[model samples]
Target: MEIFNHNANINFLGMRKFSVGIAILLMIASIALIAVKGLNYGLDFTGGVSLVVDFEQPVQIGEVRDALEKGGMEHAIVQSLGGTREVSIRLQPKDDPASGVANGGKVNLDRIAEDVTRTLQAARPDARLKSRDYVGSAVGEELRSDGIIAAIVVVLGIGLYLGIRFEWRFAVAAIATEAHDALVTVGIFALMQREFDLTVLASVLAVIGYSINDKVVVFDRVRELFRLARKAEPEEILNRSINNTLSRTIITALFTAITMAALYFFGGPVVHGFAITMLIGILIGTLSSIFVASPILLWLGVSKQDLMPKTKDNPELARRP
Candidate 1:
């Protein structure tokens, strides 16, 4: 079941410039929105209250959320726990404790909890509070810093690994591709004002790994073609490589999308952010491998010699001169 035929002759490289242009415009828009609107950091990065409650009966998650909004906790994260009557809610800190630090003063946690409980009781008369946890501003700051560090480390590790396995040009191209996927994903979150939490952060890391896998598939094909298409121009060789692997790329992305779509629909609200990030990343990463990464190779002037350095006085180089 190949999405593209074995004998396909799609000139993927020929469309690189147009694709890159579109990516550039997207990057610019994403950056601007990020600067202006910024991300909606969740309780994971901002001090907040985590509440678990048990209701006497199964209730609509939507009405519970609406009650929270009416109670002045706008955009609160609420989800049913394990298909049961239990629900967990994270109420964003009311006093700007985004730094996760107590800062010498605090809101009365008990009062806040009472107010939230009463609000939900209006929706479901039998709401019973099970437990409440207060995350300080300091904790949010640490989590936020750690999440940023993790993302940087993953990107650098990929660059180093690719550099050692392939060439620096390919490594750089891979890094650029990762950046393209990451930025677009982040931009979407900012533009939509979605909550950025631990789960969403994990999704970002997952997207980085997934994007690399797609790039490696194309890079592997390019290296194989370099040895056989020795007389072909870089663009022609790249076009051949991408066309050959196009089927595999599409199939992989298609199946992955199916899985994520199911999660988005059935996995409940708790995993919604995670599913959305992955869906966008997979699509961006697949296209970036062909348009963004391959075009970078062309700019770097990568040749057969770069792929196979063991052979001295390469025939391709000899023929070039």
Candidate 2:
């Protein structure tokens, strides 16, 4: 089970300057990317018309997209739904000034559905509309706002928990690490112009949980080492703690990344956003735990006194370690 020596003496903290520099650069780049390019919000976020169509024969996704584009439905998002014969099409709401429809006018779901059906029928005569749904711009706006609120709540909740479990230093370090992992993961989607949907958001939340779990493991080790080492410096204790848990962290991330890779390859387009987000998250989260979290803790001046149990009434016990 041990992929590395339990007694391994890797000087992880020795490279703190370089690693922290890289982490800070990545975080800055991620922030810039998000602010500039922005995320490619999917159907769930942007008000859109979605149609599930079934053709008598299997159809290539590219051909369907081409047909839609040729039919004046440009910027359509198309994907296969389980099989080649069925596909889902999503399109942003359009305005019809000629028909007196304003830019943010109510979307006519039935009319949009009819247009999509007609367009597809021209390419595939037997194309039949199976289902149609519409997300209003107002609704999408609310969902978007709610998603942001949820993320903020989760981050705050995590900070609160960490603050109580350890101390302000550990809490701040964890919050910063989690935020880094999230921004980098989400910023990649924005940079690549990938679809950011509900599934992807959920994966980001999962990444927070995963990243915090790793930090907790290492922090626990640090605390234990701090209590056990009589006169060891904080840096030495941190280095030993990270080294002791290095094997576990790498092994866990490896297998989890493998699982996410399989999902990305075999789980189909339905879960592509989720799978890919987790994959990116796993890589970033693992690296941040090793390089980012502990260094921040050290910089915050975490010491044995912060972690040592209060024994004011028992001077002998307090001085034992």
Candidate 3:
């Protein structure tokens, strides 16, 4: 069950600057890409009409898309749920009263639904409208705001947890890698202009959880080595800690990657985006745990004294002992 029988002497800490530099460059590029290209926010973040249409027979998604295009709904979002004949479509209303609500009357939600039904009628005559819904722009905005707040809360919570469990230096290092993992993942989405939806947001949260767990494992080992090898330098302890956990890390990552690969290829388009983000998150999470977080301790001047806080002896308690 052991891949590395002897303790590894790999100089992981020696290359801290190189790895940290690369991470910084990648993060900078990612921020630039996101600023310029931006993410493709899906209907979840933008107001739109949604229709759950079920066809008489199994129809190819391509045919459904073509019908939408020909019906003057080229900008419509059509997603097939699995390989079945069910497909959901979300599109902005043609005559949106929200644009001039102050001067106009109430929004005709039913009217928009009728128009979508009519548009798809020509191509699939036997199609049945199972459900109809509308998401207002205001509602989408609220959801977006809430998502951002939730993410911030998660990051702050992680920092607090690490600080209490370990030391301030360890806390900062963990947070740095956590931020790096998130930004890099978001950057990939922005670079590809992939539709950023609620599920994708969920994936981001999942990534944070996975990344933190991995970092804690390595950090815990580092702390353990600090106690055991009192004479060992910080650099040597870091290398030993990472190398000792190398086999476990690799094996765990490999198994998880295999599962994610299967989900990405076979999970269908609805969950495809989620799987892709998860895969990216897993890879980045592993890298950051090893390179980004642990190396930061070295830069922060973490010594054996910091790891083991000096215990102050109370005069009264000492007299009793």
Worst 10-residue lDDT window for candidate 1 reads 93-102
lDDT of 1 at 194: 87
What lDDT does the true structure give each of the candidates? 0.85, 0.88, 0.82
Q: Model 2 segments beyond 4 Å from truth?
A: 52-89, 93-111, 119-127, 130-133, 313-321
Error of 1 at 34 (Å): 1.4
lDDT of 3 by residue, 28-106 (tens): 9889988999888877887778888888898877687788889777767778878578998887656545422334455
Comparing 1 with 2 on TM-score, the higher-scoring candidate is 1
Q: Residues 156-235, candidate 2: write the lDDT tens digits.
A: 89989989988889989998999899989988998999989888999999998999999999999999999898996988
Backbone clashes in each candidate structure, one number apiece? 6, 0, 0
Candidate 3, superposed: residue stretches over 4 Å from native:
2-6, 54-88, 92-115, 118-124, 309-321
Error of 3 at 259 (Å): 1.6
Worst 10 residues of 2 by lDDT: 93-102
Q: What ranges in model 1 sit over 4 Å off?
A: 54-74, 79-87, 93-105, 121-127, 309-321
The top-ranked prediction according to lDDT is 2
The TM-score obtained by model 2 is 0.82
| Residue pairs whose backbone atoms clash in candidate 1 | 99-137, 100-136, 100-137, 100-138, 101-137, 101-138
TM per prediction: 0.84, 0.82, 0.82
Model 3: how far is 188 from its true place, Å?
1.5
Q: For model 1, how many clashes?
A: 6
